[model samples]
Target: MTKRIQHWLAMLVTTFMLTLSVSAVASNETSANSDNERLGESVVRQEITGFAGADYWRMVKDGQEGYTTSKSPEHGVLISVPGQTWYILKEKWMSPLGALAIFGSLAMVALAYVVVGPLKLSKPKTGRKIKRWSRFDRALHWSMAFTFLTLAFSGLTLVYGKHFIKPVVPTEVWGWIIYAAKQYHNYMGPIFGILLVAVLVKWWRKSLFTMVDIKWFMKMGGMVGKHKGTHPSAGFSNGGEKAIFWLLIFFGIAITISGLVLDFPIFDQTRRDMELSNLLHMFSALILICGFIFHIYIGLFGMEAALDGMITGEVDETWAKEHHDLWYNEVKDLPENQPGYDAAQEADKKGSASQNNA
Candidate 1:
């Protein structure tokens, strides 16, 4: 009986100790809450009073002066509101649209090719050839092409590399790639700009739009199946070629000017000026790239015998007559070894010999 009583007493003592421990935990929680409430009160008061203080965020918001060793005006800026806005626009708006402009242009070109196929020649290739682009013209064209392509690819790397390439490449390799792209873009931009200006000046007369060009456009420049027989009046350049030329001229100017503003920061352009320049640069580049897609499509594969004019600086007599009759008529009766001259003489000799036989 004494042992049973001792056991019941031990159980009750154990339950009492557990209850005391729970109460102690609850008490500690309550104390912590009170301390947190006190801390919150102090924090709230500090936050409420902090805005009124001159040093709180005045310097940040107002873009007050700070100390920096860099010579750039933007270096010491604590907080640039315009810069922040520019960043948001660049990241959120321009980048996505730029990507769309490029890829959308490419998609459209692909769709056009699939639907229309190549512009085939109605006549077979004649063995005789006629000069189209002179050697100097070819030299200038290739130089401009190289510079523009270099700038375009490098610029793409700078703009889209982080989002599109970073995930696939290692960080170190990506960094090196971006660095090289930046250097290439910066250096080639000026060369492209200069070459573009020179090319435009040299080819301005040939690219001038005329009533004949308007008619050519209406007839789809004999590229459509129904209009294949119609040789629309064209000079050295056809209507489509003129359009490409003008696109390059206008967009080249815009992109080059804006690129210059961004390239040489020593001009001391304001933050807003830099932002605007950047915006214009991106917009113009997008347009140029879109136009470039069409130019490449047509020059390379969209038309048969067209690439020969640029590559060998010559084209077949039939090809010239079919695509550019006006140009052929103008240069058809020159000296031997010249474009159109040999073909005209051959036709004349064959006709005279047949007349003598008759």
Candidate 2:
């Protein structure tokens, strides 16, 4: 019985020893794996020409620094590769801010097509033609839109260019890619600046706040579901849309002006100033990107058939009738297309006849 008890104890001890040994081996394996990932080499900084943005490159040959040390090493050396870079994570989506800008904006865009004012309509509305956009207005819009698009793509490249892309592309190829993005980002900034100025100037008059605008806000611009009625609207601009326009204008000027200072070394900027501008540029741009998502939503989907006015400089008769009844009525009173039967021509003819009668 004593021998049997001793044998059982020996078996338990052996099992315990095996478990500890396996755990130790696993821990060492994990540590080794981490070490293997790092390029274990001494770094000797060397300057090289023909590298556009690279200030210095650490020399490595066959993954080792050739330099010899006579002294017995007590402290460990920091083994690093030549490249030091920040890349956006190549994950399912970007950060919360980035995802908001893309997804929220896109969702609004889809919803725009689905509904406009209300669920059911008591009456269909018509308006006189108010000029939707002027020639200069359009040119300004397109210029900024193009520049904004360019920035979006390049900015994305800066973020995600390193992670998913670097693996597939050789380092030499990726270096050029980054260099190109930087060059384009710099060159296009001035054009964006000009467009921002135009946006501020052209819309300043109408975009200003007024008492009527306050009231327009009070009633939420008569927007209802498909079934409800649309509220009375102003001639050219509605308060809600105009408010967004103003936000864009204000932020646009702020960002673009800041971008100018950052684009080149023109302004003798303090490190603090440069840092501030960098923050402003990135944060402001991020905000604008988010805001523009809604802007895009409204411009495309928020209003029914809104994009046509931008293209051919006119909207569908049905669309104008539905969305801008009051404005449509006012424009139809003009002389050019006044004589016809559609709401616009009828109003104009009536006005002309009235004047003739008078």
Candidate 3:
């Protein structure tokens, strides 16, 4: 009986060992299958999405250019990371600030007009005409004015037209308007550069700063505050005029350089170069636009008879003496300003008038 019981115990132990081994093998097999399934899913996802995952995107963000048939600069670049930064700066910061600057200038001019009115002459007119500008000077002045105004309008349209003009016009019309503005801006830019150079050459001597200019500035050109109507002493150009002239020369050069970079992209300019030029161009333009607003105000409404010289190439003797006393004194005794010359001119005019009457 003991032998039979020992045999049954041995069989039961063998059976238990086999069961445990089978169970362990089954668990391992299940885990291995799960891992294989996950690997397969990853492969499928990569194929479907056509993306090489994080490392590929990281390369793109680093401005890594891929192979392409085109040979143009940055043509192979899938994404320009720096371009994104430039776009954010222009759209988010520069655009709004530029608008504010332009409108603010207009507002200030309006306020000045209300508060101070025009800078009228302290004395009555002498009825004697003094040559303030020669015929060539007048021609150059008007030409520059026309070109400057045209560029300003087109540039403003390019930068801020959407806010004011786009909404009011039909879609087709707006498209035409923007296209025309772009063309006008492009063609007129070189012309403006030429005029800018001419102006610098013509006026650098007169625009030089002097000790008298310092005093004139301290008195705020004798047109504001306690000095209002004082008609401060000035040379051919006042301190304010000198400031404007220099500003135009420096900023105008910047504008011209940047504008050339934009207008002619044939110089192997990369995307980064264009982006930088665009930002510089807009910034320089905004400053000039603001400065010229005050200039225009001075010409049109800030000073009485200010526009007379530009229009007729002449100003009254009283106008010259009150505004540009130094220059007037220097030129007052010229052949044109002599009593005999005035009499001769009067006689010629009367003779012509009598001929017409006959």
Candidate 4:
């Protein structure tokens, strides 16, 4: 009986071990099949969408030209890689720096006004006026001033208006404003170039640097600190004036050339040319804008009667003697510098004005 019991127990144990091995094999096979199915799905997906999509964008980014019906320059190229670089430079770097320069100039002028005050004449006015700018010179000066201010306004609006003006106005109003600014900028650009050239021709000789100008600059034009009210001797164009003139000429020429390149694109300009022109235009314009801010401050508030010559084509005798003594002495004997010369010119001007009003 004991032997028969032992044989049955052995058979049962062997059968149980065989069943466990079969179950383990079946589970592993099922898991392997599931992994194979997933791998196949992944390969199919990659074949359908992954490689072609990446290649198309890579080619576009590389600026590879493709077949197209249009004959325009760069028309076959779907994306401009250089354009992205240009946008980053203009928007990220130039825009912020340009704004800082403009506002910093204004702040400095304001500080000067508060601390130093306007430069007043040391002596009383003589009541006798001397001719300085001619009628034609005054006309040209005013015309250029008007055109320049208009262009600056339009250009600034185009660059920064989206930040300030867009949010305040309705969509339709914003559209019109931007449209008008762009149109005005495009049309008036050439006019500014012509005026700039005219100014260079008219004033280049007077703007040349001289020894007296160097001395005048050393004295800070007698308007600051220990030199206050000193009334330093100067020629017809002082050091400061000469600096402003040359600055305008140099940057004005740059602005004009770059502006022309952007304004007229018919010469088959590549994308690179336009991008470079844009950077040059913005750099030149920002510098001039900052410089003119100081110039405007001096004319309007920094000095007494500084604007008289530009406005009336004459300045008081005391002004000429104090601010430009060398020039005063040179021209003192001229007919136009005589005591009653301004009265005679005024009479003639009144007659011309009356006729025009009629």
On residues 226-296, what C-alpha lDDT tens digit does candidate 3 reach at each position?
A: 99888889988899999999999999999999999999999999999999999999999999999999999
Q: Candidate 4 — worst ten consecutive residues by lDDT sum?
A: 48-57
Q: After superposition, how far is residue 37 of candidate 2 from its true place, in Å?
A: 28
Better of 1 and 3 by lDDT: 3
Per-candidate TM-scores read 0.76, 0.59, 0.81, 0.80
Off by over 4 Å in 2: 1-101, 107-131, 163-173, 222-232, 339-358
Output the TM-score of candidate 2: 0.59
lDDT (10s digit) by residue, model 1, range 180-290: 999989888999988988998899999999998999999988776788657787877889889989989998999999999999987778788889999889888888888
Candidate 2 local lDDT, residue 252: 73
Quote the positional error of residue 165 for candidate 4 in Å. 0.5
lDDT of 2 by residue, 1-358 (tens): 9999999999999999999999999999999987765533211111132342142223332223343563323112234222121112213323446656766776765665564532232444344333466666676777788899888677667766776578899899999998998889888877777877777778778676667667677766666543234555554566776888877777777788778778765455644455556556766777778788767665665555567677655555445555556566767566543433375666788999999999
- The lDDT leader among the candidates is 3
Estimate candidate 3's alpha-carbon lDDT, on a 0 to 1 scale: 0.92
Instruction: Quote the lDDT for 219 in model 1.
Output: 90
Model 4 residue 57 CA deviation (Å) reads 2.1
Preferred candidate (TM-score higher): 2 or 3: 3
C-alpha local distance difference test of each model: 0.86, 0.64, 0.92, 0.91
